[model samples]
Target: MSYQDIRSTFKLISGGLSETIDDSPKEFVSASITDTRLMGVVSMCVHWRLPENSHLTDLHQFFYFDAEESGFETYRSVLGNGGPSEVQEINDIEDYLMGGLGGKRVILTEREVRYMLQSYVDLNLRSGLSLPEDKDEYEFMLSPRVRLTDSEEYVLMCKQCPGLDSPYQVINYFLMRCVGKDFGAAKFLTKGYVRTNLFPNHKGATLLRNVIEDSPDAVSGSNTDYHVTDDDKDFGTFNTFKSYMCESLIEYSGKFFLLITQITLDHLKIVKYEKISEFQVSAAEASMMTSRPEFITVTDLVPSAPEFDRHTTKLTSKSMVTDYENGQLFMIFQPHNDHVKNATYLLNDDVLGVYYLLEDNQLILASYNLSDIRRMELDLAESSMAPYIVPVSKYEFKDPVLFDFINSSFDDFEDFVATITKPPAE
Candidate 1:
């Protein structure tokens, strides 16, 4: 049966039950299987009105049950006051509908009742597994202050959704960190956006803005689509080779290291994130770096061994950005030694691929027998997430001068180099 028909039937049955008990104040607004996350899970909500003399407002009891082959099992029962009451086990649907199986009800304000209902709709109705057809309508009703949790992928699809205005760009950035075959380096890297006022006095600024109106490019993280126009300007002396830059502080073996990553779009529209520079700095220096817009301290990373100790290091994070930028990216790299021969790897999972830096400072992005790009192309054609997957780029490692300087600055230079050079797994 359709959800509407089922809802009506449930409401009728609930009204009948309340009439038999001669309870006029108690109301059953909904008794349908509101939860769509799992096929067999159902949600039931009932409102209990206070006595005529009582000053307190009404209460709502939201009961969640799991439908099994044998019977319905009451798993969770929550009151509108934000308290979870003890679940009174109900084995049958008839018994549950006829009798109010929720053990107790707590007093709740009108705001609290509304919050409880909205929370249930946000979580259950808009689950990843059960996406509603009309997302824009639901998104419009949700408060602008609503929190965007990890599971709200459907809500993320809506243009009017809260959180980031550019949902697709945010998704594509993290898609590289998520979807993909595991070859094991850190899958996700914390990423942020930055803007530079580099060309304040450049000639023809106002005219340029007028000629090419500022349109937000779907694939770009920036509001101004200058990359689209500036890309053509690269033909002459106007070197349009621009990059997106951001910095992060990583803790390693009790020391903080400053990491700067540069992202650039290749000719094919694929986005590549290259680790441009790194420095071992004091905590004070790390804090001072945040004064600049590009640098931000990442507080949550678990400290690991220093870079060179890892056999496979993540050199870049990448994503397949489309002409109409929507969705996320997959990863690119795996260890040179572990690459399976004749195997077509899923492009989506490797957006945050690993690499190995040689003694000469040349970075080995990926190594395998299959020399053709068609191996990845073939996988992309057959995969469901093909649109989000992008081609990988061979990014050159940063200058070795900084690498040499940092190593020399180390107190135990020889010992540190020896430990770093050793092939430790990431």
Candidate 2:
């Protein structure tokens, strides 16, 4: 395997890391979007210049060798003459590569990339000295199941999902699933966001700004119309994680957008509050005293909601709806249809399309046409804070006297927390 060939392999599969492919007929790799992030850059840097990192060099060699030894390939860049001809250091190669020795591409962090390469190395080590050192041979000999893709929901639920235990797994798991469902959902309606961490360097700038918010608390008001409208750095910078995944989702979402909750979680949580943002959320319907726990999926969460009898899209007469992938056409159909009685459809990011149920029968084919729908929202995940997720209905919040009683009667804030968090019936 040459460097360019290996890099090409990485690049070809970079966008859809969690996808199942026949690297070999019998071998299966459980690649998830969340875990396969390493591969994205691996593909990019095969022919691109990478920043230098002393610690990551060995790990890089391991990856380079893995690709090469396993039928992959690489080529030393032919440096153009008249460029600065100073070399001869342990770090000289990276500099040579960066100095137009190779073209630039998406920059993968040395640390994160090594985390992925090292994971494979460690996994190989644990399997012992007898582990196949031959890359092609190893792929040729894996259990067939190893090559199949795991369900997006199951992968995320793994939290410590062993099958996808690398930066590759992390990247692939989240991105593939998002591409199939989350990103597509954002395409039609509802607000979405991409959140990430802050760097140490930004602290000083943040502190300087804090001195000016003038209020003892530099950032104030958890939710209101003002914060969403207010253009403030208080939300933070767009990092690489957001840059990579959100951009993909953005392009796929058909360009329908309103106020974005890209800045901060706190800012987003309050988007629905009247005092919160100019962008209005669809108001709640006439909710009655059927039960409160039904809001949660895990029956154990509220005891009153049904158990996990089967994944079904049973909606109360008042709820708005969308398909598992949130496709606009599917989303639009729910307002006028009773989903529970229609054909069932499930999202299969592991595959190319939605797994649909045919009309008057249980034939599970992957499509939207000529199907009798029977269920919905089986594996959908939404945060109480998500703009689309309606937590409290208007009917429940309309009576100011009752609302105040619930809020104020809880004594201090801690009591309030416990009260709302108790059994749904409570």
Report the lDDT tens digits of candidate 1 across residue range 1-426: 111112223221111111112222443233332322111223445545434313322333434432211112222222222222312222122233322221122233333333433554555544433323323322322454444444442332221111222322222322222111110111121222222222222211100000011123223443223333453566552343334443434332345554444444333122334444555678667444322111100011112312322212112212111110111112233222111111221211211221223332222222221332233334334544333333333322221221232234333223434565689889
Top lDDT hit = 1
Model 1: residue 419 alpha-carbon error in angstroms: 45
lDDT (10s digit) by residue, model 2, range 102-208? 11233333333333344444444654422323343223222222221346323322322223223222333232223223232111111233322112121111000
lDDT of 1 at 381: 40
Root mean square deviation (Cα) for candidate 1: 24.9
Candidate that scores best on TM-score = 1
Locate the minimum summed-lDDT window of 10 residues in model 1.
Answer: 204-213
Evaluated against the true structure, the overall lDDT of model 2 is 0.22
Model 1 stretches astray by more than 4 angstroms = 1-242, 251-254, 265-270, 291-426
Q: lDDT for every model?
A: 0.29, 0.22
